[model samples]
Target chain A: MTSPIAGGVDCDLHPAVPHLTSLLPYMNDYWRDQVTTRGMTDLISQSYPVNSPISSRPDWRPVKGKPGSDIADLQRQALDRFGTAYGICNPLYGVQMVFSEDMANAFCRALNDWLAKEWLDKDERLRGSIVIPVQSIEKAVAEIERCAADKRFVQVLMLVMGDMPLGKRHYWPIYAAAERFGLPIGIHAGSAYHNPPTSVGWGSYHIEDYVAQAQAFQTQLTSLIVEGVFARHPNLKMVMLESGFTWLPPFLWRLHKFWRGVRMETPWVDRAPLEIVRSNIRFSLQPVDAPPESDTLNRLFDHMQSDELILFSTDYPHWQFDGDEVLPKGLSPDLVRKIMIDNPHATYPRLTVKEMTP
Target chain B: MNVQLRERPQAASSTGIKSAIADCDIHPARATKDELHPYLAKRWHGHIETFGVHAYQGMMEGPPYPKAQPNASRRDAYPPEGGPQGSSLSFMQKQHLDPNNVALGVLNPLNTGQGIRNQDLAAAICAAINDWQIEKWTSKDARLKGSVVVANEDGVSAAAEIRKRAGDKNFVQVLLLSRNVEPLGQRRYWPIYEAAQEAGLPIGVHAFGFGGNPITASGWPSYYIEEMVGHSQCQQTALASLVLEGVFERFPKLKMVMVEAGFGWAPSLAWRLDKVFSKLHGEVPHLKRKPSEYIRDHIWWTTQPMEDPESRDHLFQVIEWIGWDKLLFATDYPHWDYDEPSRVLPAGVSDANRQAFYLDNAKQLYGIS
Candidate 1:
């Protein structure tokens, strides 16, 4: 399928960078240890095994070689397939491994440096998220500070699952730094070692397991709100990545109900939970289609209270979802343009506004 | 006005009904220690050890069974303030009645311990819950009604309680949650159904999790969504048990409502059951009607956390599969992931179906008049 650029911006395209291995040496030791311990070190190595594809699924496999494992190959595929002028590359190294605070910081710094050297420095269209090990507040903050001056670093990427409640005041230092640097906090779902909220023994099958992932995202989001993180860090912007938007409407209403009654516990929150979410929270809709007849996308738009809150994401190379036409088929052209291009541009203006035609 | 009248066919059908809406699932506050201690026969006090609370807090907390993510930030943990005062009673009045949006709310027991173990306590607790609901909720708030929750573990005691509470004007149904009991068609539970049918009250089968049961494929889920989504599966299991066991046929008037379970999965199950039964009629000759027909005639469902986006088309598909009247709208208020009435139904749903899903169907099922 030919990838069509919506409103001149192909929001789903991702650029890849080579030379990530060279920068890996500069990564924090804690992250290196995490990659080894979390089994991600093995998984990453296996992805590029000589004979086979990185991901076993045929749909996710690259045309000839493993495109996902090599940053340069990934960029070539993006330009060739989608005619993408620029792309936001969420690196595999930052997300696939679980790192301690120190290691997470080092890994993030190394990845950011590599991104700057290999993609951001060379390509006008390339933008990046500073990957940080969220476990250590100090390291996460330092990494954010290190990347703050870079024009291509659009946001700070943090994996959502961890041992402590995300809204806990201990993480305030990172939020303070992100806020200071004017960088949005991008939280992606999925972690190698951390037990997500849905780790509860809930279902017997694959559908049940996938549903559990959505639930974990909801729980984490609620923790961020009820724990007063949004209220305390009013300027902090958060993007809930990977989780679909179908569940947000009901969750928002319930959160508001709890917030009204539980105000005594978290007095710092001046407004209802829904209001806080609307003000600070953003969600990326990837793997977007679900039973097309359900009109899920439209309802999600309504439930989110604003179309602007949802940004388009393709989760490229993942199987189970449409390759390029991730958005619902029947939506009016206007709605498609908003979701595929305008909304993301509005949220991450810096990346969206960069020179693309050249 | 003519255009509005044309839009609501279901509401149009309810011109003579007493109320516009009736909620099928409402849980009443449990007895305070003071009210419950005396009702406890000496042997049951030992059972209280299983649940740490001394009768009163047990009632306030609802079930003693812990959810997958008990500490996860949940929206349902706090109830709206300034609406009602008593722990259980206040929620009904404050959340359901005061809003005037709900005309009649059916009440269930908060504590399921009586149903799980110690039949005597279960019977006593259910009885106490019904009477307390009547005294505090139904009597003062005309919108409140009651369900007779019997101890599923002991059918005899459960039947007796059903027989006792079925005749009360305020008690309109029987409450049997999805998680606690054996399949509804099991011979052990027939007595309770018989009693409920004789009393003219439908059975309310709500969803819960693997409290003591090791039935879940893999233990329990660690997250609340997993627990909540699993309710649909439990509902399917219970629904199948009841249908295949001929609970609907044995007690023809014994209607049941599957609460807090998603409705999208219902039609597929009905089709699957109907298709399987057609080929295997010899296996279960007791069924007088097709499985799908039985569900349309006897089963009803409540929608909370109503799977929006899907709710629009899915509700229509379910209504087409069963009939237009099988669904009832609920808020599942004071719990996390509560559905807001205004926001729940999608924009494109016709007004007639919307009214049916939102209110009228529940009234018709409960015989609100």
Candidate 2:
């Protein structure tokens, strides 16, 4: 496999929060007191099973701490090894799992502050996604507004499977806020477990759980398009993080075919679903979930006419791919460059500004 | 098998006459619930009038996401004679079978009550549907064939139903729903498979059933669009369950056909299953082969709402991954998105592959001569 060129932007890198106590310092006095008094330090890991082979790459795991907790280790393994000039840190924690809107908001605030201070502040190459409390739209929008002030926070992170379909009007404020600040909404592959991952119910093993992520992404994409999220917020960008890309071409095809037949129902969706997906939705590269054969990837790329849809993501500490195999083998050099750097720059307005600056 | 079946494609292509097509998924619904009343037992006829259907799903009218049209079908598909879409054999012949040059059309009548909770009721309704198809459709048109509908929830009865229709040439395959009480591979459903294999019939699994579970893992999807696209996901789970649980290993001769659920995901699903099964083979010790091997050897996919990739070449690649011989043509007749046989395949397909996809594949699988 060919190594990615230097100066590429890593769109998805998980910054681990070791323990609940770690974020306690970042919380406000009232929230800090509430945590101490309530003894609410045991935050559950939302999607990641700590010991899964996929949660941490064998090489990236630290000798002492949780795999992604150490900043120096991440820099050495992800940034230095892949030659990623800019890496976006998406902190996945159990903040979205909290039921109370107030508590969820408090945890989200602490999570963002901790991310900004521990990861983004320590490394110039590091950028972050503002972790928001998606349980309540008002608080999510407020959180987005609060974090948008810092250009280092390039995107807003929402779990792919949430309480309601992400396209409903209740969630429009969050999309509107992200669009206003020119920030893309990053829907990462994690679930709140509000419902079973499959419509039939939960699967028996992790493989079923892991495989179901692609299906979840499909549901969200269709929901967003049909609910008129794109038509309403024309300038918004939806980046599907760690969601496999190969399944998309077929899903879009099915979507478009049905759209042609049922366009009368969703009248606002004027164009074909494929056209809308190309213009609005984007997918991350790693966990390619495709046949390793070069011809398969080539045909997939051919199906995905636009090269800009895929942004380079190592998904650091996540064992999606092995060694320098971050970029799938068959891509041409031009396509590689576009995925690693050009696509990220185009997707995130903040990244463009960073590149232009001295 | 008929020698003319292979030559028919070439002859039809060369002549102005439409090419011979074998539609593996043509839905034929009842004009009214009362139509099945004659075939149903006296008890069921009274039950239908009173309580109505008590399916596994929350609502009996249909899926939560109301179809684009009244039966979730194309508006124009409603017959000129004024019955619900797909209810009239004469209308189907004029609009779909005859116009499309469908040499053999396999009827998958879903309204036969597969999802109903009461096994006896579901079985009774399934039997009535079979008798109804013979009287209304297969008997009326020599070109039309039927799928033996069964209450998959109760395998004993389902096997019996399969056996009852096995000798009849009009019934080609045993039809089951994608959504069921349990994953199809489990021992509960094995009897149905045994009956099918013994009878030398392929099991045709059409999408849409009330499996006593939400349409999605995340709960009922809010929109019709999400529910529609989800048809393939259900099939993916079923195929994985069938392979991993060793259904193919136990019943080697059993042929399975996935109809209506698009074929695009088959390649990815097989790859994912094989990739995981390689490392986790211990979980399913009964399997002797890779998941893809069983899928390739046993399972056949029908192409309707056939994947239309942005690049036509991409769809060709998908077709290649899913071998031409394993693919059977289906139009999902009278549904909102029926693919016209002539227009479905893109330019890159070779004449031989095209002939096999439209006719020969289904003929060999169903033993149609």
Candidate 3:
């Protein structure tokens, strides 16, 4: 059933990178010259090919450029349409795609700046995700430090699929920065393409690649849990953007089951996997990946054991749900409130900016 | 038989429902140490001593994340005779097979060299494992049946092994690990599927096989829990590869029983595959039917590492979506996360569904009279 109410917070809305030229203004002199000299084209991701149905809803697509590129369209279709009190702009630009560490850092800086200038700065209601070069922890931490000053930048963003599992100690510096800055780590669906999209091998179709993304998130989530990411950085929250929520309950159950038998390996995991997930993980509600029956979806909610786990999202311009029915059918009124507003506020403490006295 | 069926023996099941049932996923280690070495040619032994088994990873000790328990087996399962937990027949019967009333138990022998990169060595070890299964365990135990363990990466050798074991009453299916060199559906692995179909034996892809790559697509995880949960994730990829790449269409009669991987993910994975296939059917035009249809027509799943969702009904919903007949009951005996058949299924299951889940499905799938 569609939510009868408004005033929700859309946690995951993509503001597309129009083309390489748009990022030039944000890039430094050396990178700008390199881009012009190399004559690079747009860096749209393969996971969300521009023409694919999954990339953007039919009406939400911008006629001139990429979907979510035009701020006016996103405002009309997403914010105003849903009466979103606050919306987080998770830029799905290819900032983490470059092989060179310096190039990745440059692109990430440009992406964050572009999100701030083009999206966040334009709308008081919209917030930005700080895209970081995940390959280099030093650069990633530096980027987090640079962007945390904006307060408008609420979360540090990285791809679900990257060079290694996000839980490894190598990536802990980024998480440490996020925890220190009171910014959650927003892990969005998409990959750095360093490895095959799947553990077995590369699949033939885009659908295979897209569907396989959930598996990537599962692996990464497990890595985070087993690797003691949460145990070490206890205060941090990791938001799964566009990585569906319905799968979380079972995924946690599986981990909890195995963790019992293998608890000795990671002694830092002092609590149950379920408890850790409750304490740290939050999923943005979109692409529900659920059966249509309200009762069935409701049963899944029951299995999840908490209403506060999901923050609301239209996954705007991503063709997740048509029209406004961004909220799935089964949520009760109280549950909707938790998902739409309370959950987001609780997950991203930085969502509410305080006034400076100076 | 009817009177005995009506009786409720406490030891027969952890829950109340008690009757002799078929267990689809029992792992039986060798009866004695070095039992398989006799089956292997002497030259391989010298090669093994000189170079050792080249594991997929750098470590020779085994998985990077060690199990909480020794060999990831039940502490009580170790035999008094000083072998591994599953390495003794009488001990297994005493602990699990007899007490649980496991009428017909299928043996899944893991930790073979099927996952090694050296194809010739993998094939030799696989052949030795096949011989060891018969001469050691299945030959002595009438209730036990063997799986034709194959070098999953070397399809040609695997198929040849399957053909060699064709119509052997002791052997019921061919075994492959969920994690392989590539998705099992690729043409490289088609030969094994074809041979299994020709032999009229189901191919059982059990979770936790020979590990080749970092179990996760991105890389190795921090803990063994990631590897454990990764079993289902890898199987999803295997099922998708099999359906999308026309494994089912090409080998129409081939039957696949996904053992040890939890069954909860089947409905959702198939649904996701169907949704994507509808939009991107052109990419895989070779598919003769929807991915879900192929899944319904071909695949069978075993219930091990049974999902304990917050609500029992969620598992019921998954089963209802997958179908009543599609699930084969398994007790991952001697393993750390073993599911007791009596206690695993949620309470209030109908007798007919229980019959299908515990006994009828596996009996029919394996062609057991």
Candidate 4:
């Protein structure tokens, strides 16, 4: 009977919107009428199919309603159970999938409001991520501008696999806005399904889509670095949530190798990709993909070179681990403190500011 | 330009490989653009002259992500006799094969018509390239073996070509690009796998192809580095598709070797698949075994641009998870990201593992012995 670690900051907690209709009170009157008149039901992203074991831990799951819908459950299971000092709410509603730009923006606004009022307001330990409708760059920036003033919003949220790679110049405005407010852009796994989940084409099994998330994260990481996103936004930090980090060492080796060989094409990339990653990129700690043995996990950590890269997270109700074994076995007590507290504080400046405020 | 593989120490040391060595990936290029023209029919000659192959990438003449260096080859690799890297057989032997003591080298020729949109043209070009590999490579050197390049999009035709080359010593395996119009596991590609199984040849899915899809799950990336890194991701999707589509169950005898793309992700990829499989096995009732079991049995990977982690043993851990025998040594010779024989396998590898990784595995997989 081991004790759970206390005072850790949980970086990724998915607070599910109970149903599409629940956002009605938060939505503008015009959009509320539009949603009801259109007869919209659930907009759950297939990425997290309800009832999939990975969608929610069997033990934490409720008898009814959505897996991550209840604030009380999140507070007890995710916050108190793990002794988390703060838990960031990254609502995984299918607002990113809405085809209509107008619909996506409206829903994104409503989702942000719902997150603040229902979840953040309920728990002082909870923080919010601004879920931007990324279909239109201008609107995405506008949403960021609207949400940035709310000090409770700690990060800007986007899906890992969107219609375009996240690094395109068009999307820089949103990054710029987020940067202005010291908000790190958190890229979570799952796609818009605007394209096939896999690079080649769609796969038959749900597991195939799940496996492809790591690959999608790698592509976006490459996109972010090689497309000069890191170079352009020198101080901006990008957090990859639910993105596995075991593949990082080799990925950096391969990317750094090519960047050296072909520096002429993208001359703006003045420093090594690995250096850039160490500086600007932060990865969530969950879904440890290395073999379960702590020795194997530690060896991968050795490969990671920097201990500061990983921040702790339960990936709440996501069934990434069995019980309270959210932190993999191998980490040292010092590393545990950094992963759970220091790293998350460093990556998310708002957490530090809020902690300092009171 | 500053590659040290060309100048890496050649002396056989205590740690050096003592037995036979096999390089599973050696990309042989064309000296000239019309090198395979003579192998093609006169009908294709005019089509080639006028209607060029339609590719999925935006650019018709060059790759979507422009390669960092010309031909994406090592600076030292271009033959003094004046042709592209790997274009001259003698240069390969002098620079890589003989020096590295490669006893068996498999030729994987790229920039072929195998992936083009026109099925007829792709078929003709594939056959021509197949014939050309025999005349220009295998016939000239017994150390090398050829891969039967096929029009992978046209499954029936790809199978026919495999059957045509079946049991032929000139070719040791069938070659399919990682990226295709549809995931290779689709019924569209089963014919090729079936024929390869019948032929007793492993199908090598080297990482490069375009099926009109973006190089990434998102869309076209900005740099060649992304494409290079994207190779492993593309192969991951390929393996996932093949596993979940029950390609292994349908033709259990068909073996696959993922070439060029690093194999570090295999164990984790399989682990995730198996983890999910335990819950969602009902979705794929056709599968008799777990996804890892299928992967462990049927899939093999070649080492090139090998994972150079901070701790060398970290790679060994992945190799341990992905069984030692499943890895075949590859140099990806003449390419800029070539993995030299001595340099790739980090220190502390046991003799038995090294023997299997460098020689025994490829020999058994390709039946070279």
Model 2 residue A78 CA deviation in Å: 0.8
- Between which residue pairs do clashes occur in model 3? A1-A329
Which runs of model 4 end up more than 4 angstroms from their true locations? Answer: A1-3, A352-358, B2-20, B80-82
Top-scoring candidate (DockQ) = 4
The 10-residue segment of model 1 chain B with minimum total lDDT is B1-10
Two-way DockQ contest, 2 vs 4, winner: 4
Q: Give the per-residue lDDT digits (tens) of candidate 3, residues A202-282.
A: 767787888888888888888888888888999999998888776677677788877776677788888888998888999
Query: Each model's TM-score, in the order given?
Result: 0.61, 0.90, 0.93, 0.94
Tell me the tens digit of each residue's lDDT in model 1 across B153-255: 6778888888777667887778877765344566877888888888888888777632343223223333233344445555665676678778788888888
Docking class of 4: medium
Per-candidate DockQ values are 0.02, 0.42, 0.59, 0.61
C-alpha lDDT of candidate 1 relative to the true structure: 0.58
Residue pairs clashing in model 4 are: none
**lDDT, candidate 4, B1-369, per-residue tens:** 545555566556323454568999999999998898899999998997897888666676887776766788888888989889999999887887777788899999888877798899989999999999999999998999999999989999999999999988999999999999887788889999899999999999999998878878888777677788898889988898899999999998989999988887787688767766776787788899989899999999998878765567677777888899899999898888788687778779888988999999999988876
Considering every candidate listed, which one attains the maximal TM-score? 4
- Candidate 2: regions farther than 4 A off: A27-46, A352-358, B1-16, B57-63, B74-82, B139-142, B163-168, B181-191, B275-288
**Tens digit of per-residue lDDT, candidate 4, span A1-358:** 1234799999999999988899999888999899899899889888999988789999989989999888888888989898888899989999998788999999999999899889888888989899999999889999988887888899999999889888888789989898898999999998888888889987777877887898899999988887888888899999999998877877787787667667787888878899999999999998777557787778778878999999998999898888778888868888889899888999888974554212
TM-score of chain A of each: 0.80, 0.97, 0.98, 0.97
Ranking by DockQ: 4, 3, 2, 1
For all candidates in order, the CA lDDT equals 0.58, 0.83, 0.83, 0.86
lDDT string for model 2 (B162-212, tens) is: 999888988999999888877666678899999999999899998888777
For model 3, residues B113-208, the per-residue Cα lDDT tens digits are 777878899899988988888887888888899999887877888889999999899999999888877777788898999899999999999887
